[model samples]
Target: MLFRQVTHDDLGCASYLVGDDAAGIAAVIDPRFEIDVYLDLARYMGVRIEHILETHNHADHVSGHGRLALATGATIHVHRLAAPEYEHEPFDDGWELALGEVVVRALHTPGHRPEHTAFALVDRARGEQPWAVLSGDSLFVGDIARPDLAVDRVEGARGIFRSLHEQLLTLPDSCEVWPGHLGGSMCGGPGMDMKVSSTIGYERAHNPLLREPDVERFVARSLATLGPQPPNFEAIVSLNRGPLLATGVEATPLTPRQVELKKGEGALVVDVRTDQQFDEAHVPGAVCITSLSAGFGSRLAWIADREGEILLVGRDDDDALNAAKLATAVGIRRMAGFLHGGMTSWREEGRPVATIERLAIGDLPARAAAGELQIVDVRERREWDEGHIPGSVHTPYHDIDAIPAGIDPELPIAVLCASGQRAAVGASLLARHGAKHVLHVVGGGVGTWERAGLPIER
Candidate 1:
C-alpha cells in the first residue's frame, strides 16, 4: 500500500493519496483546487488515479475535485445523502471500494455536515483489523470537529454531536485516525490540540469532546465558537461549477513598464515577498503580505476591491500564479496583471524603486544609548512572557487593533516580533492608527543581539 499525506501550511488542510502500487490504481482524497500536484505524483508513481473522494462539502479551503476528475478521467465519489448538484457517484454508507488487495469502506459520519463520511482502509488478508481511517472533518487529531458549518449554522452543531456518538466513538481503539485538518485552520475549533493526526485510543483518552455524555454542551459551545469564515470560500467552491481553469486566476502578466503605469494610476501595488527581500528594494507603492503562493490569493482578496484592477509583484512563477489565484478568489474580476519580469526585471529596466529602512541587532545598542529607543513588541502574550527585549512595550499583533485611548499614538514606536510577518502587521496597524513615526525591526534580531552579549533589560 502506498500512502502519502500532502499538507498545505497556509490553509492547514491534509489531503491524502492512497494507492496499491501493484494494482496500478489509486484514490485521491480531499484535494485542493490545484490539480497538478496529484497528477505529477500519480505519474511519478506509475499508477493511474481511479477515483476522487470528498468527505464533506469543505468550508475552510477549496477542494480540487472537479479539476482532478477532468484531468485524470477519474470518477468522483461522495456520500449518497450529499445530493451534490454536480456529476458524481453516490456511495451509500458501508459501500466498499476495492483496489487489488486494498479496500476502502465508507462510514456515514454525519454531524460536521449532514452528509459527512469517513473512509476506513481495510487489509482483511493482512489481518481483520483496519489499517487507517480517513476521519475527514469528523475528528481532528487533537480536537474533535466543531459542529458548526455554513448552511444550517448552529443547528448543525446538534447534528455533529449525534454523528460523533453514533459513528466515531464506536470505532476500534487502535484505529489509526487521519483527519482532514490540523492546527491553525478555522474548520477545527480553537480548542484543538496541536497535532495533525492521532490514533482513536489517543484521542478517546485525551480529547475533551469525547468526555461529554448528554452532547448538549458540545453542540452549544461548538455552535457559539465557530472560527472566522474561511477566506474566499463561496467563490472558490463556486469555481468548481464552471469550466476548470488550469492556473487559478489566469490573469495576464504585465511588464515592469505596465506595473509602473498602474502605480502611476494610484493602484495599490502588492509585492508578496519576505520582509528582508522587500526591505532590500521594492516598487515605490507596494506592500508585502506573506502567505503561501496559492493561498496568497485569498489574502489579496481581503485587501483589494471586489472589481479592483491592481498590479501584482512577486518573486517567481508560483508567486505570480498565487497572486492571480488571490485575484480570482476574492471575486476581484479585474487584474491589470502581475509585474511581468518581477522586481528584478523592473530594476533592470531602469524603473525607479524605494527601500524600507532596515535596523540590525547592533543598532539597538546605539538607539538605547541615545535614549529614544521605544521598543513595541507585537507578539502574542504567550510569546511576550517567553522573553522579550528589555524595556519593550507589549502589544500583541491582532490586539494592536484598538488604539488604546489616551495613550500617545505619536510616540516613536519600533514594532518588533519573532520575524517580519507579525512586525509588518503591527507596523501597518500603527500606521493606520495615526502614528506619525512607525518602524518595524526588519527581523526579530534581539535573540542575536543577546547571543552577542548585548545588554538587555533583564
Candidate 2:
C-alpha cells in the first residue's frame, strides 16, 4: 500500500492519494480543482487512478472530482444523499470498495454536510483491522468540523455529535485519523493543530468536542465557536455539486491603454501583488489581494460583486494566470484579462498611481494618542478577543464593505490585521468606500503591538 497527502496550504485543504501497489490502482479523496497534481502523482507511482471519491459536497473550495474523472477515466464516488448533478457512483453506509488487498469502507458521517462520509481503510495484507480513517470534514487534528455550515446550527451540531460518537469514535483508538482540512481553514473552529494527521486516541483525548459527552453541551459549544463563513459559500456548493466549468481558460493580456479603458468602464482592478509592493504604489482604485495569500480566492469573491468584471494586475503573466485560476475555483469566471506588463508598465506609460501611507507600530501610539488616528483592527472576532489596541474598533476584513456605524469616515483611519496583508486590503477598501485618509499598518499587527510591550485591551 502507498499513501500520499497533498496539502494546499493557501486554502488549508488536504487531498489524499491511496494506492494499492499490488493492483496498480489508486483512489483520490477530496481533490482540488487543479487536477494536475494528482495526475503527476499517479504517473510517478506507476498506478492508474481508478476512483475519485468526495466525502461530501464542498462549500469552501471547488472540487476536482469531475476533472479528475475526465482525465483518468475513474469512477466518481459520492454519498447517495448528495444527489450531485454530475454522474457519480453513490455509496451508502457500510459499502466497501476493494483495491487489491486494501478495503475502503464508507461510513455515513453527516454533519458538516448531510451526505458527508468518512472512509475507513483496512490493509488486508497487514491485518483485518482498519489502519486509518479518512475523517474528511468530520474531524480535524485538534478540532472537529464546524457544524453550522450546512443546516441550522443546533440540528447540524446534533448530527455531528451522533456521527462522531456512533461512527468515527467506534474505530479503534490506535487508528490513524486524517482530516480534509487543517489549521487556518474556516471549515472548522480555531485551535486546530498544524499537523495534518492525528491518532483517534489523541483526538479522543484532547479534542474539545470529543471530550464533551453530552449532546446538548456539544451543540452549545459548536454553535458558540462558529466563525465567519467563506465568501460565495452557497455558489461554491452549487458548483461542486453541478457540472464544473472546464479549466484552462488562459488570461488575455491587455495593453496599458486597454487596461485604462477597462478601468474607466468599472472593471475591478485587483492588484495581486505583495502588500509592501502594493503599499509602495499601485493603479488608482485597485484592490490589493496577494495571489499567494491563503483564502485569496475566497477573499476576492467576498469583496468583489459576483456580477462585476475583474481585471487582474500582477507582476507578470504567470502571476496573472495563478490569480485567474484561484479566482475561478471560487466561481469568479468574469475576468476581463490581465494588465499586459503589470504595474511597472503602467507606471512607465505614465498611468496615474495611488499610494497608501504605511505606519510602523511605534508611530501608532503617538498619532493615536494625539487623537489624530482612529485605529481599525480588521482581524477576526477571536483575534480581537485575544488582545487588541485599546480604543481600536473591531471590523473584520471581510465586513469592510460598510464602515461601522460609530466610526466617523472623516477620522484618519489606520487599518491593522494579523499581518500587513489584510490591512492593505482593508485600507484599500476603506479608500474605495469614500474614507478620506486611510493608513495601512505595514510592519505591525496586534501580535507586533503585544510583543512590543504596548498596552492591549482584551
Candidate 3:
C-alpha cells in the first residue's frame, strides 16, 4: 500500500493518491486545479492513475479531475447528486472501487454538500476492516464542514447531523480521518485544527459540534458559527459543475503599452510583488496582492470580479507564471497575461507609477488624535468586536470593494488588518475603489497598538 497527500496551503485544500504497489494502480481523491503534482507522484510511485475520485463538486476551488483524466485516460467518479457535465462514473452509497489489495468504499455523507462522500480505505492484505477515511468536507480535523455553502442552511445542517452520527461516526474509533480542508479554509468554522490528520476517536471525543445530540440545537449552533462564504463561491461551484475547464499552459507576455491598453479595456492589473516593492512603486491604479502571502490566490479572488480579465505584474517570468497558476487554482481563469520584464520593463519604458503611503501603528494615535487620518479597520467582525481603535471604522478587508459611506476621499485613509499582509490588500482595494490618499498601515496593526499601551474601544 502507498499513500501521499498533496496539500495546497494557500487554499487549505488536500488531494490524495492512494494505490496498491503490486497492482500498480492508484486513485486520486479531491484533486486541485494543477494536475502535474499527481502526474509526477504517479510516475515516481511506478503506478498508473486509473481513477479520479471527487468527494463532491467543490465550491471553493476548481478540481483537476478533468485535466488528470485527459492526461492519464483515467475514469472520473463523482456522486450523482453533483450532476456534473463531464463524463464520469456516477457513484452513490455503498459503491466500492478496488486497486489490488486496497479497496475504497464510498460512504454517502451528504452534509457539506448534497453529493458529499467519504471514502473508507481497506487494505485487504492486512485485514478486511477499513483503516482510514477521506472525510471530504464532511469533517475537518477539529471542526465539521460548514453547512451553508451548497443548500439551505437548515437543510444542510440537518444533513450534517445525520452524516456525522450515522455515517462517519459508524467507523471504528481507530480509523484515521483525513479531511478535504484544514485551517484557513472557509469551508469550516474557526475551530478547524491546523494539524493535517485526526482519528475518529479524537474528533468524536473532543469536537464541540459532536456534543450536541439534538438535531435542532445542532442546526442552530452550526448556523450561528458560519463564517463569511468564500468570495465568488457560487461562481466557483458553477464552474466546477459546468463543462470541464482546462488549465492554461502559459500566459501571454505583454509589453507595458499592451498592458496599459488592456487595463484601459477593463482588465485588472494585479501587482504580485512584495508589499514593500509594491508600496515603493507600481502601475497606476493597479491592485497589490503580493504573491508572498500564502492566501495570495484567495485574496486575488476576493478582490477581482469574476468577469474581469486579470493582467499580472510579477517580479519576473517565474514569479508571474506562479501567480497565474495560483489564480487558476481558485477558478479565476480570465487572465490577459502578464507584464513582460515585470515593473522594471515598465519603468524603462517611462510608464507612470504610483506609491501608497506607509503608516506605523505608533504614529496612528497622533494621526487619529489630530483627525488627519481615517483608520479603516479591515479585520473580521470578531476581531473588531474584541477591540479596535476608538475612531476606526470596521470594514472587513474582503468587503473593501467600495468606499463605505462617511469615508472621505479627501482624508488620508489607513487600511489595517491583524497583519500588514491583509492591510496591503485592503489598501489596494481602496485605491481601486477610487479612494485617494490611501495609506498602507504597515509594521503592525490594532494588536500592535494594544500591546504598546494605546487605548482601544471594545
Candidate 4:
C-alpha cells in the first residue's frame, strides 16, 4: 500500500493519498478546497485517483471532494448518515472498497458529526488484518475529536466515547493511526500533539481520553476541555454539505478611487499586508489581515460576511491574488477586486492614510505605573484564564466591537495577544471605531511579559 499524508499547516488539517502501486489506483480522503496538491501527487506517483472520500461534513474548512471528483472523474463517497445534498455514494458500516491489493473499509464513527466515518486500510497482499486506520476527527494523536461540533455536547460526547472504545480501540495495536487534524486545529482539544501520525498502541497508552474507560468520566473531561469553536463553523458546514461553488475566483484590479467608492457602498476592505506595514499607514477603516498568516482565511472568515463583497488591499497584484485564493478556499467567494497599485498608489494619489500607535513591551511598565493606560488582552478565553496582565480587559479579537461597552474610547488603550499579529488586528478595529488612543503592542505578547518576570493576574 502506498500512503502519503498532506498537511495544511495554516488550518492544521491533514488529507491523505492512499494508493496501490501495482493497480495504479489511489484514493484521497478529507481534502481541503485547494485540490491541486492531490492532483499533483497523483501525477508524480504514477497513479490514477479513482475515489474521493469525506469522513464527515466538516465544520472548519470547506472540503475539496466536489472539485477533486470533477477534476479526476472520481466517485465521491461519504457515510450514509451524513445525508449530504451533493451527489455521492453513501457507504455504511462494514462497507469495504477494494483498490488493487489495498481494501478500504468504513467504520461508522459518529461523534464529531452524526455521519462521521473512519476508514481502515487492509493490505490483502500481506494479510487479512488491517494495517492502518484513517481516523477522521474521531481520534487524534493525543486527544479525541471534540464532539460538540455537530450535536449536543453531552449527546455527542457519549457517542464519541462509544465510537472510540468499540470501533477504533478494537483495532490491532500495531496498526498505524492517521487522523484528520493535528495541532493548531480546532477540531479537538488544545492538548493535540504536533505529530501528524501515530500508532494505535501509542494513542491507546498515551491518549488521556482512552485512559478513562468510564463513559461518564470521559464525557465530563471532554466537555471540560472543549475550547472555542471556529467562528464560521456553521456556515462552513452548510457550504460543505450543499452544492459546491467555484474555488478559483480571480481577483480583479481596481483603482484607488474605485476601491474608495466600493468601501462606501459597504464592501469590506481587507488589508493583506504585514502587521507593521499596516500599522504605519493604511486605508482608513480597512481590517488588517496579513496574507502570509497561517490563520488568514479563518480569521477573515470570522469577520467578513460570506455574501458581502470583499475588496483586497495588498502590496501588488501577486499579493492580492494569493489573498483571493486563500479567501476562496475558506468559502469567501464574493471578492469584488484588489487595489490596482496597493497602498502606495493610494498614498501617492493624495488619499488619506490612517495610522495606529505602537507601544513597545519595555515601556508597558511605565504606562501601567502611571495608571492611565487601559490594556485589552485579545487572546482566547482559555489563554486569558491561564495568564494575562492584571486588570486587562479580556476581549477576543473577533469580538472587538464590545470595546465601547467595557472600555472608554477617550482613554489610552493598548491591545496584546499571544503574538503581535492579533493585537494589530484588534488595534486596527479599535482605531476604526473612533477610539481616541489605540496602541498596538509590537515586540512581544504574554510570553514576553511572563519571561520578563512581570506580574500576572491569573
Candidate 5:
C-alpha cells in the first residue's frame, strides 16, 4: 500500500492519493482543479489512477475530478446525497472500494455539508483494522469544520455534533486523522491547526470542541465564532456541483498596448507583487494582492469583481502564471491574460502609474492621538478584540468596499492590519472606493503600537 498527501498551501486544502503499488492501481481523493500533481505522482509510482473520490462537493475551491478522469479514464466517486451533476458513482454509508490490499470505507458524516462523508482507509496487508481516516471537513487537527456553509447554522451545528460523536470519534484512538483543510482555509474556525495530520486519540483528548459533552452547547459554540464565508462561496459550490471543469489555462502574454485597451474595456488589473513593490508604483486603479502568502487566492477572490475579466500583472512570466492558476482554482475564470514584460515594460512605455503613500507606525500614534487621522484597523474581529489603537474603527479587510460609518472622507484615513500586507489591500480598496486621503501603515500595526507604549483600547 502507498499513500501521499498533496496540500494546496494557498487554500489550505489537502488531497490524498492512495494506491496498491503491487496491483498497479490507485485512487485520488478531494482533488483540486490542477491534475498534473496527481498524474506525475502516478507515473513515478508506476500505478494507473482508476478512481476519483470526493468526500463532499467542495465549497471553497473548484475540484479537478473531471480533468483527472478525462486524463486517466478514472471513475469518479461521490456520496449519493451530494447529487453531483457530473458523471459519478454515488454511494452511501458503509460503501467500500477495494484496491488489492487497500480498502476504503465510507462513513456518512453529514455536518460541514449536508452530503459530507469521511473515508476510512484499511490496509488489509497489515491488518483488518483501519489505520487512518480522511476526516474531510468533519474534523481537524485543533478545530472542527464550520457547519454553516451549506445549511442553516443551528441545523448544521446539530448535524456536526452527531457526526462527530456517532461516526468519527467512534474510530480507534490509533487511527490517523487527516482533515480536508488547514489553518488558512475558511472551511474551519479560527482555532484550526496548521499541522496536516493528527491521531484520533490526540484530537479526542486535546481538541477543545471534542471535550464538550453537551450537544446543545456544542451546537451553540460551533455556531458562535464562524468567520465570514469564503468569497463567492455560493457560486463556487454551484460550479463544483454543476459540472466537471477542465484545467490547463494558458495565460496569453499581452503587450502593454493590449493591456491598456483591456483596462479601458473594464478589465480589472490585479498586481501580484510584494506590498513594497506594489506601493512603489503600479498601474492606476489596480488592486495589489501580494502572492507571497497562503491567502493569495482568497484575497484575490475577495477583491476582484467576479463578473468582469481580470488582467494579471506580476514580476515575471512565472509569477503571473502562478497567479492565474490560483485565480482559476477559486472559480475566477474570466482571465484576460498576463502582461508580457510586466510593470517595467509599462514604465518604459511611459504609461501612467499610481503609488500608495506609506506611513510608519511610529508616526501613527501621534496623529491618532491628536485626532488628525482616522485610523482604520482592517484586521479580523478576534484580532481587534485583543488590541487596537484608541480611535481606530475595525473593519475587516475583506469587507472594505466602502468607507465605514462615521469616517470622514476628507480626513486622512490610515489602514493597518497585523502586518502591512493586508493594510496594502485595505488601503487600495479605500483608494478605489474614493477615499480621498488613504495611508498604508507600514512597519507594524496595533501590536507595534502597543509595544511602543502607545495607548490601546482593549
Candidate 6:
C-alpha cells in the first residue's frame, strides 16, 4: 500500500493518494486545483490512476477532478447525492472500489453536504481491520463539520445533526478519521484543536458535536457558530465545475510604457495600495485591492466581473508580477500588463494620486476609550479569543462581503488582525464592498494597544 497526503497550507485542506503496488492501480481523494501534483505522484509510483473521488463538492479551493479525468482517462466517482455540473459516476451507498488488493468501501455520510461520503479502506491482503476513513468535510480532526453549505443554512444545520448522529457517529471507535480540512480554516468554528487527522474514538471523546445529542442545541450551535462565507463564493463554486479557464501561464511583468499605451485599449487597472494612498491620488477608475489576505484573488475575480482585461497596478513591479501570477492561479487570464513605473512613475508623467485616512492601533483603543469607534477584528475566532482589544467584534476577513447586511456602514470600521497584514486585506475588501468609513489598524491588534498602554482585554 502506497499512501501520501498532500496538505495545502493556504487553505489548511488535505487530499490523499492511496495506491496498490501489485495492481498498479490507485485512487485520489479530494484533489486540489493544481493538477501537476497528482500527475507527478502517479508517474513516480508507476500506477495508473483509475478512479477519482471527492469527499464532497469543495467550497474553498476548486477540485481537480474534471481536469485530472480529462488528463488521465479516469472515471470520476462522487456520491449518488452529488449533482456535479460536469460528468461523473454516481456511486451509491455501499459501493465498493477495488484497486487490486486495496479495496475502498464507500460509506455515505451527508452532513457537510447532501452528497458527502467517507471511504473506509480495507487491506484485504492483511485483515478486515480498517486502516482509515476519508471523512471529507463530514468530519474534521477536533471539531465537527460545518453545516451551512449552498442550501438553506437552517436546513443544512438540521441535516448535519441527523448525518452526524445516524451516519458518522456510528462508525467503529478505532477507525482512523482523515478529514478534508483543519484548524484556521474559515469552514469550521474556532473550536477546532488539531489540524491534520484523528481517529473516531479520539473525536468522539473530544469533538464538541459528537459530544452533543440534543438536536436543537446541535443545530443552533452549528448555525450560530460558523463564520461568514467568502465574497463571491457562489461564483467561484460555479466556475470550479464550469469549463476550464487557464490562469495566464507564467505571466510576465508589464512595463510602464506598455501600461500607458494600453490605457487607451480599455484595460481595467486594479490599484492594490493603502486607502490613504488610494484616496489621496490614484489612476482614475482604478479599483483598490491590497496584496494581503487569501480572498485577494477572490475579490479581484469578483471586481473583474469574472471577465475583463485585468491590468494590475501594483505598488511596484514586484507587486504587479505577483498580482499577475495570482490572478492567473484563480483562473483570471485577461492580464494585459501592469503600471511599470508605479504611481511614482505615473506621477512623473503628471498622473494623479488619491489619499484615504487609515487608523493606527493606538488610535483605535483611544477612540474605544472615548466610545467612538467600531473596531472590526477580522482575524479567525480562535485568534480573536487569544488576545483581542476590548469591545471589538470578531468579523473574519473573508466575511467582509456579507457584513454589510448586518454591520452598519455608518459606524467607523477599523479592521484589525493578529498582525497588520491580514487587516490590510480585510480593510481593502470592506472598502471595495462599498463600506466608505473603513480603516486598517496598521499596528495590528497588539502593536497599537501596546504602544498606547491602553486597558488590554484578554
Candidate of highest lDDT: 5
Give the whole-model CA lDDT for all candidates, comma-separated.
0.71, 0.88, 0.89, 0.89, 0.90, 0.71
lDDT of 6 at 219: 84
Residue 307 accuracy (lDDT) in model 6 = 58
lDDT of 5 by residue, 238-332 (tens): 98898788766678899999999999999988899898888899998788898877889998888778898999999887899999999999989
TM-score of 6: 0.76
Off-target runs (Cα >4 Å) in candidate 6 are 242-253, 257-304, 313-418, 426-439, 446-458
Off by over 4 Å in 1: 191-196, 220-226, 240-247, 264-268, 291-298, 316-335, 348-420, 426-436, 441-458
Clashes of each: 4, 0, 0, 0, 1, 13
lDDT of 2 by residue, 344-442 (tens): 889998878888888986788888889998889998897899899998998988788777667788878999997787888899888877787889987
How many steric overlaps does candidate 3 have? 0
Scored by Cα lDDT, where does model 2 land?
0.88
Clashes of 4: 0
Per-prediction TM-score to the true structure, in the order listed: 0.76, 0.96, 0.96, 0.96, 0.97, 0.76
Off by over 4 Å in 4: none
lDDT for each residue of candidate 3 in 1-458, tens digit (9 for 90 to 100):
98899999988998999999899999999989888899999999999999999998888898888788889999999999999998889988999999999999999999889999999999999998889999999889988898888888899999999999999999999999999999988889989988999999999999989888999999988887687788788888888888877655468999999999999999989999999999999998888998877788888888888788999999987789899999988888888999999899999998789889988877878888887888899888878888999878988888876897789877789888877889998898888788889999888899999998998899
lDDT of 1 by residue, 1-458 (tens): 87888876666678998888888899999887766778888999888998999897776565678778888888989887766667889988889898767898998987777778999988765876677899998888767676655456656666777767777777788888888877766677766655767888888888777776766787665655465455555565455434443455566788887777787886767777766677677776566665543345445554565555777777865686675664543445566778876778888988777655566545766775676657777765645665677777887655554554433666666767775566765665655556666666764455665676775553
lDDT of 6 by residue, 1-458 (tens): 87788876545678999989788999999877667888899999999988889877666666777678878888888886767767778897789988888888888877667788888888888877677888887778877677766677777778777766776677778878887777766567767655577888888999887788898888877766677564445655666656543233454466666765676687767886654566566765566676544445655654564555877776678877766655644556667777775677787877554444567765676676777767788777756665777767777765555454446777777777876766765766666566667776775576457555765567
Candidate 5 or 4, higher TM-score = 5
The TM-score leader among the candidates is: 5
